[model samples]
Target: MIKTPSLREHIPKTFADIPETTAYEAGYLVTKNAGWRNVRPVIDKDKCIGCLQCYLYCPEGVIAKDGGKVKIDYDFCKGCGICKKMCKPDAIRMEAEKH
Candidate 1:
């Protein structure tokens, strides 16, 4: 049996305060808002070694291999900071998006 982490394990308890109905209705709203204001991963091309480590480690599938560099999809990036943490060459850095 493959084990998958629970949503509650990843989402903070504060999110539970949202009523189920509102939560359902606001899911897209939340995602849209996150895209507008959440921190985004910026790749320093010169620092990247073309190792593809960030592409393999992003949980949100935000990182994409672009030729010899990596690109981040801000629309889907949740700012989890995992890519920054996993980059072997320390090429990825998190920067807050201007709201």
Candidate 2:
């Protein structure tokens, strides 16, 4: 059976402990195929219960909690539909990214 880290093991205890990523935001970053995604996830605020299932499952760590709402950072998101699949309330939807 596959094993996953527990919530306590996954989340950082403090902001200082958060892992840093320079590849996502660094010089010449705009040239890193920033807008190449054909699809992206959008969260429906009305339906979102802030369950954070999406945030927990996001491999890129681009999803964050803001004002008790779940926010997706499209900049680092790879158009993966994991968030939508994990959302029990069906709050997240994958829509075509508009050029």
Candidate 3:
């Protein structure tokens, strides 16, 4: 799991609220740039064919197999769109991040 700032300290109002980052948060390329992302990936389970393309292409280690389905960990996903582009079945799509 992504080790984000403790919510018990003071809840982050948005992704931009949390600043400190470790490589464990996202990937090296995106760990400190989470707020810079304008979009986020969301997967359509029915459209997914269990190809694992998203899981393999995801750089943030946020994609995983859960009950034979691809689960996306938004806590660490940097919205880089690698998974969306790698999805042959068009299962994943990037949506505008709502602040």
Candidate 4:
């Protein structure tokens, strides 16, 4: 039902400066907001065990350690649920977005 461009279309036979490939083509860092996901991660302080698993596995780098507790940054989180599944202590849970 979906169609994607071919790999050859994205890569060139020779090296040259292309405008379309400029974004992250040469190991550059880019930050973009991904807060449009349908769900979000919420951390429970009481249930957290301070293992830091969620922080290490977060793909968006939205999880962090505050003193000894884990905190989630909703602005950049894409709600992929990697943190929720990686949290062995069951501290993080994925809930539907309020809006």
- Model 1: colliding residue pairs: none
What TM-score does each of the candidates earn? 0.61, 0.67, 0.64, 0.65
Candidate lDDT scores, in order, read 0.66, 0.74, 0.73, 0.70
Best by TM-score: 2
lDDT of 2 at 46: 96
Q: What C-alpha lDDT, on a 0 to 100 scale, does residue 48 get in candidate 3? A: 87
Residue-level lDDT tens digits of model 1 in 7-80: 87865354233222211222354445344446877889999886666666677655665665667766666888
The digit string of per-residue lDDT tens for model 4 on 23-87 reads 22222335556647899888889999877777777776666556567677666778999988998
From the highest TM-score down, the ranking of the candidates is: 2, 4, 3, 1
Ten-residue region with minimum lDDT total, candidate 3: 17-26
Candidate 4 clashes: the total is 0
Candidate that beats the other on lDDT, 2 or 4, i.e. the better one:
2
State the lDDT of candidate 2 residue by residue for 1-99, as single tens digits: 899878889776754454443124433345434377888999999999876788778887777766667787676688879989899999988899779
Task: Give the runs in model 1 whose Cα sits over 4 Å from its true position.
Answer: 1-33
RMSD per candidate (Å) reads: 12.1, 7.3, 13.3, 13.1
Which scores higher on TM-score, 1 or 4?
4
**Which candidate has the top score in lDDT?**
2
